[model samples]
Target: MQFTDEDLGAWVARQRWYAGKSHVPRFRILDVQPAPGATRYLLMDDAGAVPALYNVPLALVDAPSEGDAVVSRTADGYLIDAARHAAFAVGMLAEMGVDVGRVTGSRVLSGEQSNTSIVFEEDGHPTIILKLFRTLHHGENPDVTVQRALSDAGSPYVPRFLGSLDAEWPDSGRESGVARGTLGFAQDFLPGVKDGWAVALDAAGERRDFTDAARDLGTALAGVHAALGASLGTVDAGPEQVASTGLTWRRRLATAAAEVPAVADRLSAIDAVYQAALERPWPQLQRIHGDLHLGQVLAVQDGGWRVVDFEGEPLRPMPERAIPDLPPRD
Candidate 1:
């Protein structure tokens, strides 16, 4: 089945994860590849001032009534979101080397912005979650790289990294099939777990003692950090790196001031603080999770905490996200 850029642009604008949601997109197809039981598209768009790339996986069916996952109907076939297609979900697990006896049910998990997650359950096999990255990068995704490294280091603070799927394409200025991008990530899903944010909020609402849980979470974070540092060595920030970091802070503040005029009043004060911080010795930089919050963690049944989502800040560039940076800026 074939689809046009116009069709994709309109559908992408309505998606919550599209960066250029407020404006109409002008898309250019970069590459098309065959996935397990679906088709994958790499699209570039100049929707805003800058150009962006995205990955769209589609499942084609002869008729709309064939599946409940239909996304749109075209002259060629009925386009369905691959994440919502049962056959595609099972095939994705197999591509990741999961030995699930058989997929009994599959559904797309909601409340996500940048990617689509599908949950697969079987009678005897462990439940699996597949995260399909929406935005496309030229190289390995940090979410997959970091998690795999941590899992390999025997860290108990992360879910088991089963495997991942990637595709190669011919990008401009590169040799044929030189550019590779991550398609999806597979991991073990822990059932009966509660998000740390929800647990904390519930505890606060009930006025329950959460000190023990907080301490355990801190330990888990420290353990993950240790594992990452061991796997990917740390580097001492040189003077030049420190200066660059300070410049980034100023640039961010300037952008914020331009977007929200109210920030103008405190601009000077913020700059003063940044200048003072520059005078102090910089801390050693390592590949720590760039964005860590209560919501990025889960509390398991045994009173243990597990960190998830190593994608970093959604606004940061892919290169920066993969490198060693300062600890999450609270």
Candidate 2:
């Protein structure tokens, strides 16, 4: 059975992870990959300034459940958002080729800004979290590889990487007319943990000394950097890389000036500093959490610190995200 792009356009716009929310999407179904109990739809959305691809997995049921909306009527069942069902988690595990015991339960995490993540349960207890990538690309997702590397290294700074799913599809842009990309990833769920940002905020609000916590966080970050360097290795910042990075500085200055006219007044002063930085010696760059911040760290009670989301800037191209970078969080 097949469905049209129009079947998903309106529904996609309502999704939290949809980028072009302002405009109704023009969806074009690219490929359909049948999983255990779901069908993964690869779509190209042409409603934005540029065409964007997305991965949407769906399932059909006999009747609409609590939050299910009947996308269409079919003789067998009604098409619904498969990610909301437990079977979707089963299919997701099947898709990722992982065996984390029989999935006893499944629930979507709230306040997801990008990908659709579902917490899966085993033996009637929650355990694994699978993130379905909303935006599609044709390459290795660093979020999987970097974390996987650290996890394999027995690093305590990150959760254990369960597995990841990837698929190949037609793409005329590539020389082979085919491309491969990650679909989703599953990781062990860290239960009863708090974000460093919240803890810091509370400490600040209460006027409590946070030196110990801050030191622990710095240690954890250093451990993460060390693990990444050992796993991925580092390279000297060559002339070309430095020049490219300097160009990025100028670009940032331009953006800052444009965004705040007041910043334009001090543009020359900023440029002078940037010029000085360009002429200075540069350190070896390595794989890093390109988008690191306080919010990305977790404070595990009785534990040190744990970092998550190794994938670089979400806005950067996938391949670029995999590149070795400065720890300064570009």
Candidate 3:
């Protein structure tokens, strides 16, 4: 079944994962590939200031599907989100080279903004959480590679990396007009647990001292940093790198000033601070969790802190996010 411009574009425009919500989605199918139980589509949207590429895995079914998973109904039948389809649940694991027989049950994990995740159970316990990247990029995903490196370095702060599914497709953003990158990743599922932020909130509500837990969180963070530095190594910021960083800061300030009038007045002052910082001695840059906040971490019961979601800033384009960055930004 083929999606018309109206149906597909309208559907994409309505998605929470769609970054260009303000602009009407102008989608063009860049490429399509047939995979087990689904057809994977590489869609491009030029409506936004920055063109975005989307990874859309779809399944055509004869019957209607429940909820938002249903994209549209056609004469051919219904086009549904393959992630919700039973066969797709089994098929994606096959793509990751896992045996389907071992998966006792599978269900979608909700409240995610950027990706779709399916929790696969084994022996009646959720064991693996497979996350499919909603946006397409042209290189390896740091969430997979970085976490795998940490796991290999025997870092206890990260979940055990299982495997990843990657693919190659045409991308105008790439100089070669084609690129290869991870499509999804499967990792050990850390069951229901409150994140540090949530734990802190509870502590505050109960008027309890969280000093020890906060200290432990800091220790865990430092350990992860050490593990990454040992595994990925680090490099001193060169003159060119420092200059580039300053340029980025200025660009971000300009953007903020443009969007918010209040920031416009302080733009020059902010620029001066950026210049001052650039002149100071620089710290070694290494691979770190680019986007590290309280929400990105989980406080497992009696298991210490287990950091997750290493995908970097969700707003930044893919290739740029995968680059080594200053660890202090975490």
Candidate 4:
């Protein structure tokens, strides 16, 4: 089955994970890779101010059932979102070479931003969360690299890395059949754990003292930083690196000022703060979670915390995300 650019653009615009939601995207198919039970398309969007890339994996079925995950109806069959289909989800796990024993069930997790996550459950084996990378990059993703490194370093703060999926493709304007991209990642899932954000909110509502938990969380984060630095190694922030970072800050501020009317009023003050910060001696830049917050963590029953989602800011470019930089912005 095949789809036109217009059809894909319309479907992409309706998806919650799509970055360019305000305008209709002009699509260009970079490559197509066949998965176990689906077809993955590497696409480039030229609609926004900057061109962006994405991965759209689709499953073709002869007919739609009552609970079918159909995205569109084609002449030959119904197009389904593979990430949301149980069979496709299981196939993905097999592709990743994950030995989950006997897979009993699978379901798509909600509240994901840039990628689709499917949770596979089995009786004996540990539950697994398979994250399908929506945005396609040329090489290794920091999420996969960082987690594997930390897990190999014996870090208990992160989930155990199971396996991954990648594809070779022929990219235009480049050497044919040399380009490869990360398709998805699989990791152990901690069941019965609550998100840090929810835990914090509940504690606040109950007027419970969370100072100790906060302190422990801080300690764990520090340990994670130490592990990442030890494994990946770090470099001193040279003058050129500092200058480039400063420029990024300024560009981000300018973009915010244009998009948010309220920011325009304090642009001068923001610029002043940025300049002042730039003048100070920069800290050694190393691999860290590029996007960190309460929500990116989980609280276990034993008063322990597990950090998840090493994928950097979804809107940032892949190359920039892979490079070591300042600590997570939030």
Candidate 5:
């Protein structure tokens, strides 16, 4: 079934991709196109105070495609197809005369939660990974923002950002409005290496050692820290922030304890780690990985780990999700 403006608005509100829930947001169709028998649309809105965009590409596949077609079921919620939702994205970009040649092949990257991403090769030179941002926050995204800064600083570890495609606001050129809303990003697709998380999981699942993987990740984390510091200098970690970190940990632990009950007994053990972190003889301020996990690193063909997706955890607020953050605060 196709979505009318009202239907699309309600449908977007119900989506896990919607991102904002506190207010009944407004949506404007910036562009539209026919996709064979399907309908492609680009939508923009102030999701509460968060300015966001969506490229809603839905196929009228004889009835309606199940919710699972566009969203992947996850432990938290459905993961949106930020990457492969291209029909509408193409329509949106068409306004700017963005040329989309024939598609070669498209594959969804694994280990995604909120956003959807798909990699496509164009004549086999400079493959592009299109990322649709899941959560919308006003202002430029820190992932794109920081990565661009790092790229400008000549860092080669992160993929070279090519450009972004999004919908332009109709009233943007007017005295008081936004010019465009970001829809997706096109970046150089790194080839070959399996994601660090998959490698680690394989090793663990096969009863093999993960020491090498862990060590490599540790080293990559260090390099990422250094590069980030070079790009965005260190800052002081205030006592208030430090105390707040401890309290946040406590609250997280408390919530988990409430859910699992037995975890309450291990609070002391967790506290030991926290206290050690606080007492460690290290710089309290440095630009470090805001969200470092096994999956965020990749083992390259050269055997060194390449850090991927500097976009911090989606669960965190936008302000705290970027690098140049107080190292200890992370």
Candidate 6:
């Protein structure tokens, strides 16, 4: 059943991704496409000054609400706020087509900073993770797009690609005034792995011997870069191109200097580093993790790291994020 605009409005406000909590946002459903029992919505949310689209996937839950809310401590538990829970219980579930007759318990995974993810398990068997995308964008999400590309290319580091759900409308007369289409995704549950950031920070904080781990990471990243380069196409590295690396750093420094008053001195220092990086020359340009930080990787227990979340830096515009010509993350 298609959810009403009232339902969509109430649901989005409570979600962690709804950046505009101060006021009620308006929605415009652009399109709708339905599957066997589920539907995908393309939504336009006007929350204050920011307006964008999101992909939301949901399934119904039955039985009793016997489980405690899943909470994440990484972002200080901000993602699991009350509004988010309400949306999950009502808006999200309302769109799902699953007929879960019995829900034994619900466990929310802690530590995720971006999406409000809930792990639903029944009869002691691990099920799927409901990923509520916090930030919305147009076009295909890189996480989903890249994962499909990698899976098609037979990459092993990524988790198995499970079916996803999105929102869409049949015509202009849909009750949901907002183009409520594909809002979220569902992916296979990857168990027993620590996010790379927590692991790296743990190692850094403890001053433990992490050279081997770092080398392993370096190799894995290199492989991914190589794969991406081959899959797409690699550009030849030139001395001039390498020298321009400092430009990006300079731009970052300028941006930091404008907004952070206390960081003026630090920005100056960073400027010097940029100058140095400029003088050193540029590395070969190839497709790689545009946003490669510790947080982007997951360390599985089976002796390897799994690269997830292909979505680039949120600060960049959507077009720039998809620009195939950009350099890799520093």
Residue 6, candidate 2: how far off, in angstroms?
A: 1.4
Candidate 6 on 116-156: residue-level lDDT in tens?
67665567665656666655554456666666566666677
Question: lDDT per prediction?
Answer: 0.83, 0.83, 0.84, 0.83, 0.61, 0.58
lDDT of 5 by residue, 1-330 (tens): 223566566667776666667777788776664542345566777656656656576543222223335432334333333234445444433332435675454555665656777676566543666676655444456667666666667665677776665444345645666444455565667778788778877888999988876776666566666777777777666766566666777878888988886898887898889888766544546555567666677777777776767667666776666534555443
Order the candidates by TM-score, highest first: 2, 1, 3, 4, 5, 6
Q: Look at candidate 6 and tell me the lDDT of residue 132.
A: 60
- Scanning candidate 1 in windows of ten residues, the lowest lDDT window is 63-72
lDDT of 4 at 94: 87
Q: What lDDT would candidate 4 get against the real structure?
A: 0.83
Off by over 4 Å in 1: 65-67, 124-126, 173-178, 260-263, 328-330
| Steric clash pairs (candidate 3) | none
Model 5 segments more than 4 A misplaced: 1-6, 9-112, 124-126, 165-182, 205-209, 268-282, 323-330
Q: Give the true-structure RMSD of model 4.
A: 2.6
Question: Poorest 10 consecutive residues of model 3 by lDDT?
Answer: 1-10
Better of 2 and 4 by TM-score: 2
Best by lDDT: 3
Judged by lDDT against the true structure, how good is candidate 5?
0.61
TM-score of each: 0.91, 0.94, 0.91, 0.89, 0.67, 0.66
Candidate 2 residue pairs in backbone clash: none
Q: What is the per-residue lDDT of model 3 for residues 55-154, given as tens digits with 9 covering 90 to 100?
A: 8888898996555388889889988878888787778887887766888878888788888899998889998889889887767888988888998998
Candidate 5 TM-score over all chains jointly: 0.67
For each candidate in turn, give its C-alpha RMSD to the true structure in angstroms.
2.3, 1.8, 2.3, 2.6, 7.5, 7.9
Model 2: ten consecutive residues of lowest lDDT: 67-76
lDDT of 1 by residue, 1-330 (tens): 446787776777677778887667888877788876888777788767867888877888777544355657888878877777777888878888887567788778778888888888887444888898888787889999989999999999999998998877666757664778787899888888999999999999999999999999989988988888889888998988789889889999999999998897899999999999888888788898888999999999887999999988888888888667775452
Give one clash count per candidate, in the order shown. 0, 0, 0, 0, 2, 40
